[model samples]
Target: MTVKLRVTQLAQLEMAALGGIGLLLLAAFFFQLVQGELPCAFCNLIRVCFMLLGSGLLLNRIYGINPWNYVLSGIGALIGSMLSLLFMFAKALPTTKPTGSAILGLHMYTWTFMIFTAALFFCLVMATLYAQRDSLESPGHALDARPTWHKGVIALFVALVFANLVSAFLQNGFDHFMAGGQQHYRMLYDGDVMKP
Candidate 1:
């Protein structure tokens, strides 16, 4: 049997999902800073995917859930999964291991693939439920005032995403180029530091 979610419940779920994403991003940074694991280009791409997914949900909280939001988020997830898969199979650079770190015997890129796949599944489920609605009318709480916790969750999501972008810039420098095989962060002053 299919279950329907009320507008408020849906909003709460979106906020929760965004919070989860924010936390995951924070963890990534933790690994980067605490563990001294610099993110390669592929890792940065995965971070962008998470940010994109969070942005979609943030838009939903602000504008209400819509088909287009799901579409965009799903696309982001797909791209992330594809990149993850590519890195998983490709040979590692001479200076670095094939996988950076492992959690539960699976590498971070593998986890990224799983996360993207799960997000895509969630989008599919939500879209199907929305399609089964009887009326075309909105639930009408799109612009309503949200609880403080909801606002906090949204703020956290925004902060984490912005932090990811800044971290990427610091790691990759201002150059438009990205090196997936890079083993360490590249500083702007490091001339010819592209060697892996």
Candidate 2:
């Protein structure tokens, strides 16, 4: 027999998925800090999309599940997948060098494309399934009823969002535009002078 999930169970699954995205963001930071592999403009765009997806998930967990939440995340994934494809295409060019190191024989953009595509598919599936079920968009599914783990996932995503904001400013400085293949943070200084 096919096991159908309750609305609460679906909400919990969304929380878990958001937590996984948080881990991915952390890994990106690790690469930037530990490996010194800075993200290109395209990479930053993909990261932004992840943030958008997380924001939608956050809204649902806080205000209860709604179709608008899916729309927000689905649009993010759709745009992210497109951006990933363009980045991959750039890497395909003869003179275009690869951005960052490859992981598991695939570039970061390639992996992101797969992830965005998967996320888009997931949103579609989940939205359809959620619509088919009974309308439990009531107080029965309030945030206070959820376990602490749900709040933990929200907290993790929120932290990552702020961390990414700080890191972006550090990388690009006040200009808000990072140079291609930038090696050091523009905001950093050496001795008495800032690196220009």
Candidate 3:
């Protein structure tokens, strides 16, 4: 016998996947704190894309699953893929140095490229599946009644978004522009540079 997931179940699964993505960011932040390695501008942009993707997933969870949610997330993944590709090629050049230490033989940008591509595919598939189903609400679970873990996931996503914003400000200052290779926070040391 074959079993099919209801729209609600699929949405919950997607949200869980997005939560995993959020944890990935937290892991990235952990590496930054422990290893004293700051992300470059490209890396930051990729992270922003990830946040955008998460935002789309959040919308679907809160407002109900829609094709537009997948579109929003797919756009983010597409942009992230392009940025990761550029970053990878830049690092691949003979003159340019790799930004962070490689994890499991592949650089972070390489992993991000793979991740974004996968996410794009995932969004497409989920959207198609969502389209195939005719019903929006399932009798199994009420949309209003969310599990505790679901709430945690949303909280984590929100926290990560705020943390990323603050980190960017701290690194690039009010002007939001800084050299990618700089080791120290421009806003912290350069008092005059903070002025726009």
Candidate 4:
């Protein structure tokens, strides 16, 4: 007997996954603000990759699963993994130690690489499973008839991600540019460079 997920259930799962990613980003921010850890240029790039991944999932939740959504998520994961690998071996920031607290003796970038790899794998599995389904109804069809709580949750996740983008812009600059090995949070406080 083959068990299959309903379109609504699949969308809810995707939304939940995106929400979890948002929470993880929030945790990173907490560490940055409270623990005095600063994100380097590569780190910011990794964050952008994650935001891209979440955006793909958000699209899946809203428009129903499509091959393109998985492709988008996979691309984001691939870029993030490549960035983390570059940081790990290329001495991208030779002067600064790896930012954020280490987990299990591995730097946060290493963990991010692992996370992105896992997300890529998950997207592959989901894509394969979705391909086996007989119906391709839009998830929004069910969502329109459902309770408002799920919509609220999706809105909150979008807002959190938008806030993150704003914070990144404020920290980086109006041009959204930062050189490797430069200072972190440079554009904060009206373009005043803060010592990291």
- Who wins the lDDT comparison? 2
* TM-scores, each model vs. reference: 0.82, 0.89, 0.88, 0.80
Model 1 alpha-carbon miss at residue 141, Å: 5.1
lDDT scores for all predictions? 0.77, 0.82, 0.81, 0.75
Alpha-carbon runs more than 4 Å astray in model 1: 1-5, 91-96, 134-144, 177-196
lDDT of 1 at 1: 21
Model 4 ranges with Cα > 4 A deviation: 1-9, 91-96, 142-149, 179-184, 190-196
lDDT of 2 by residue, 1-196 (tens): 1334466578778888899899889999999999988776777878899999888878877876688989999999999999999889988988988888889999899999999999999889888977885564662356677689887787889999998888888777777556457777766744464343
Candidate 2 displacement at residue 110 in angstroms:
0.1
Q: Give the TM-score of candidate 3.
A: 0.88
Clashing pairs in 4: none
By TM-score, highest first, what's the ranking?
Answer: 2, 3, 1, 4
Task: Give per-residue CA lDDT, model 3, range 136-194, as digits (tens).
Answer: 64434444588888888988998999998888888777765554765776667655543
* lDDT, ranked from best to worst: 2, 3, 1, 4
The Cα error of candidate 1 at residue 74, in Å, is: 0.5
User: Higher-lDDT candidate among 1 and 3?
Assistant: 3
lDDT-superior candidate, 2 or 3: 2
In candidate 4, what are the lDDT values of residues 1-196, reduced to their tens digit? 2244465566667767787778778877886778766566788789888888887887877777778989999899899989988878755467866556887888888888889988889788878878887556555655576458667766876887787777777676776455444445656554444544
Q: Which parts of model 3 are misplaced by more than 4 Å?
A: 1-5, 138-144, 190-196
